[model samples]
Target: MSSGLIDTKPLAGIALASAGYACFSMQDALVKWMIATYEVPQILFMRSLVIVVISGVLMRVRHHPSILKSPYRGTVVLRAALMLIAWLLYYNAARSLGLAELTTLYFSAPIITVFLSILVLKEAVGAGRWIACIGGFAGVVIAANPSHSPHLIPAAMCLVAGFCWAWSTILIRLVSRSESTLTQMFATSLLFGLACAVSFPWIWRTPDAEGWMLMIGLGLIATLGQFLLYEGFRYAPASALAPVEYTGLIWAFAYGYAIWAEIPAWNVFLGALLIVASSMVLVLWERRSEISARNRAAA
Candidate 1:
């Protein structure tokens, strides 16, 4: 494993992850709405189509000419498969779970991502990152305020979805070392789109004007979110960005309030404060680490 100055750019990764999560939270809100009327595969297929077009158009002529000829094809394919599984399971669970419950359950991902960063990538994770991830999780639980209802099946599906997504993120950091962002996006979205297409025909619901608008918006948002998040991984290790994932729950709450006029209670504010504070602490800690790393290099 080759790691260069990965220690110095944690803030960039954290910031990008924050923005990416906000977009994802919005995407979730849209999916939560669309799932009520359309099938999961259909929604994903549409989303993937937009991502594919954007990635394809933005890909440079100077980059690798063919996705098939890539040296990391196997790893990229595996990552794409995991992502497809993650979205499929997540959307299916969305059909039965409330957005709060869905976000709460998926919050388990940061822990999984950090653990994999340690075990798989052999990255040295600091106590500050660990503390942030744990604290942020506490905040998510408070903010989302999921029900204790034993909707066992959907709950289980959500946990699995989180794990798959977390693993795919690790793969993202792994490939970011060598893969072009556009190439990965193009390959992942292309493969993702094709996989979803297999079932798209069976579950197709002709979209009305509003539905078309929403799906197109979903695609554009997905592309931007993936680009930022993937670029973040290029600058910082996955473990450092793990805690940032919790911020999505905050966005989920905000979007919920905006879209449904659902007023969050006191717990939401408290959780938001903790989430923000944990992120700040991690940012300050990372700055210290980067300075120390630079001094050592200078020495």
Candidate 2:
């Protein structure tokens, strides 16, 4: 029940963040598989159903009825809608894109988060953070290599998805000030599930046994990943946890290779290196800034 900004457990946050990204990587892989045969809305509806059930159970187990209530209901609904849009775009892109490539593009979220924080939260970002953000996007451009006409649509989708996700992250941080993590998760699940369900009449299709299992796995993994991510933010500053998300590149590459025999081009590796390094610089800078502020207060 610690608020996202007030908690100061960086190590635990990093660990949770890393684990959450790993789960997300896996979920993306499954979604990639499922989307080949199923509609995006269908996949979303089923996966969100699983999330609602699991998150509801967790809320009940925690015996926190407040987890079902939120003072910021409007923001919660907006965040959930943004998440749903982001997922739809990402998954649609995933259906055609290499996992690593898609992930590299989506990794733009952290950078976008920085700028959004500046604009929305009025968080004063230093020159170093700005440089890091520029460098990170430069890396994304290099990795994306959008010159290839065929990749343009999917790449653009990923970029927009990253933007939406960044906004969702900001909202989560804002709402976490007064909302329980469970409330955040539950509301997001319920809202997104309902949204997707509204499309079920047009998108619904019978799934084979294999499809059923994969869809269920997708739900479970995504729910857990999102929960862990929310918890990670609760334990540490988002900047400190940003770099840990780069670990998903490794998972994406591994899953891409193992599942689809897909290997990223050399530019992807290079771009990933730049992006990860830049993001880490921002994280380190933020950590130092936090330390300096604490010391100044103590003095």
Best by lDDT: 1
Candidate 1, residues 162-201: lDDT per residue as tens digits?
9999999999988776777788888998888898889855
Stretches of candidate 1 off by over 4 Å are: 1-7, 60-64
TM-scores, one per candidate: 0.95, 0.85
How far in Å is the alpha carbon of 261 misplaced in model 1?
A: 1.0
Candidate 2: C-alpha RMSD after superposition: 2.9
Worst 10 residues of 1 by lDDT: 1-10
Candidate 2 runs further than 4 Å off: 3-7, 10-14, 93-108, 150-158, 237-247
Give every collision pair in model 1: none
